[model samples]
Target: MASSGQFAIVTGASTGIGLELARCCADEGFDLLIAADEPEIERAAASLRADGAKVEAVQADLSTSEGVEKLYAAAKGRPVDALLANAGRGLGHAFLDQDLADIRRLINTNVMGTVELIHKVGNQMRSRNAGRILITGSIAGFTPGSFQAVYNASKSFLNSFSFALREELKDTKITVTCLMPGATETDFFRRADMMDTKVGTEKKDDAGDVARQGFQAMMDGESDVVTGMKNKLQTTIANVMPAETLAKQHRKMAEPGTAKD
Candidate 1:
């Protein structure tokens, strides 16, 4: 059985869905370790603290090894009852037009950072014999993106990693969940400079609702949870459609000059 002091670490908890997830966990009376690259992390920490959650805020870039190491060090000696590996960003425009540094950061944060954090915390959870992990994957992973190519590919890797890791730890008490959401209202699009794109400005689902679904599914030990009916339908269509067709459909939404929506 887990103790009352058990901790839940949520990366990217400064805003958007990650912030909502942190609030959700705190509402359930769990201590929190919230990480973000922004100064807003302190504001989030303060809010959670005021709400009676014992919160620790760490402002570190999750796109680098040093940043991830900082978070791991902060979590040492604490029993991680739950972990939300939710830190991520998106990119827009032609892949060739993007700066090499930006591309590297996207890959590092979405792929390498997630993999390393999961590997470490996952082992600790297994050792403790009880834990739950919720990874943020995107609906874009199901199809090949044109302008947003690298971001989608990174999410595809995350989707695969979460599912495979879940199977590998099936005998243990630790639970792993992958959350797949599509076109949620978030700073992601704005940050990616993709607000003009269809996926960015089109009518979107709320981040809070999406986070709630994932949080509930994590508690239930579900392997994967797709939020919103439209998103579910999209996932279903992606499963049945040919890769070439899906990629073509995505180009209209993701390509810079196209505006099919």
Candidate 2:
């Protein structure tokens, strides 16, 4: 368990994996500053408070620089001991079918906002020579996403960036951990408009289970962890499979109207 005074920040804490991650932190005795774009963040914070940790919830759209700054300001200058950059957006459809605004929002939230926050918090952690960072990447990054093109690409960027950052910080007390989960049981599918796809309909790991794996890996200072054994195998195969084959496989699962009976 962390010391009671330890401070942690978790983004996307309104629901799903992010909320679960925040719960894990609170259970481990860390004061929390959790943020999301929705009002539900307040309710999530209330639930976390039951864990006997101080909790602050900020409702801010993390897709914009202003929103990211608002969340940082809400931290009240506390030196964050643990940072979970879990906020993200997903889109599902053929590239050409996606609205320009939606595409930009997805990229801004999943890539730009995530990187900016990491840069801000990471610099502080580096200067202090102490801190832990967990980035929520995804196994989808390992393969081509035929329907969910932009979302997967953003996750790929995160996957690569997390590794590079971890290596750069190897000599310091600051640890950068990436948590790659696959098809977790969350609102993600519905929000991404993927509920009609085979992958969306398939069984998924529980959000709590995925969060537990990620949280434990972060606490142990691991560089990366892919949650679930099935996902582990998928990632391994994705690495060896030809790009064209991988893309085709992704199409079968993510192509529109492939929902199972």
Candidate 3:
């Protein structure tokens, strides 16, 4: 992709797809403002800087207004050319087996925090009427995640919300693109406590590849882009498959200990 000397903000950049997405932005010649809840975000920033990219990393808990404000403040009134709202949380196992606190945190980070940041930055994009927004949704949103209910639901919300937002901005230059990736090689499965499950243990797509696909789609202003061919076929089947059947299939992959079962 050709380089653009612009500004962008990518959240959840400490590791995984978020970090790769930030790299794509830098490669495209965009000055970056990246954030994550972990201190590793600073390290990610340093590495990007080593490559001659101008990056500002913020360690903020984006599940609250304060964190959202901190990120928005970092831009200091400069217009953002792109907003990669990629911060999200995941949880595995039965809903009943999970603590409500963890569940709440997951929901807040995935849904609330993401929406808050978008509402703030999206308005600025609107005023300028030229910006690209890439949201990291999941192919898990296509089905009912039996053991991973909340996380899937949050992604479904994002998938739906992206379409609505895109339509709302259809008359403008602002484009909202949802990047729906299936399982990818990332710390997400471990962080979600699903290492014992089949999907967690199975081979998955590369995070860098996924990020490149997403970034390209966003630059082209596509409505949505699912990362892999297998995932694309799966989602196609999901459209025709009954919800209960999809849920059952999801259970087989996401249920704890299913890898050995």
- After superposition, candidate 3 runs with Cα above 4 Å error: 1-3
Q: Please give the range of 10 consecutive residues that has the lowest summed lDDT in model 3.
A: 1-10
Q: How far is candidate 2 from the true structure (C-alpha RMSD, Å)?
A: 1.2
Clashes of 3: 0
Model 3 scores a TM of: 0.98
Say which candidate scores most in lDDT: 3
RMSD of each: 2.2, 1.2, 1.4
Model 2 C-alpha lDDT per residue in residues 154-206, reported as the tens digit of each score: 99999999999999989999999999999999999999999999999999899
> What is candidate 1's CA lDDT for residue 190?
86
**Each candidate's TM vs. the true structure?**
0.96, 0.98, 0.98
- Residue 160 displacement (Å), model 3: 0.3
For residue 63, give model 2's deviation from the true position in Å. Answer: 0.7
Q: In model 1, which regions exceed 4 Å deviation? A: 1-3, 257-261
Q: What is the lDDT of residue 98 in candidate 1?
A: 98
Tens-digit lDDT string for candidate 3 (1-261): 334779999999999999999999999999999999999999999999988899998999998889989999989999999999999999999999999999999999999999999999999999989999999999989999999999999999999999999999999999999999999999999999999999999999999999999999999999999989999999999999999999999999999888854
What clash count goes with each model?
A: 0, 0, 0
Clashing pairs in 2: none
| Model 3: residue 64 alpha-carbon error in angstroms | 1.1
Candidate 1 has what TM-score?
0.96
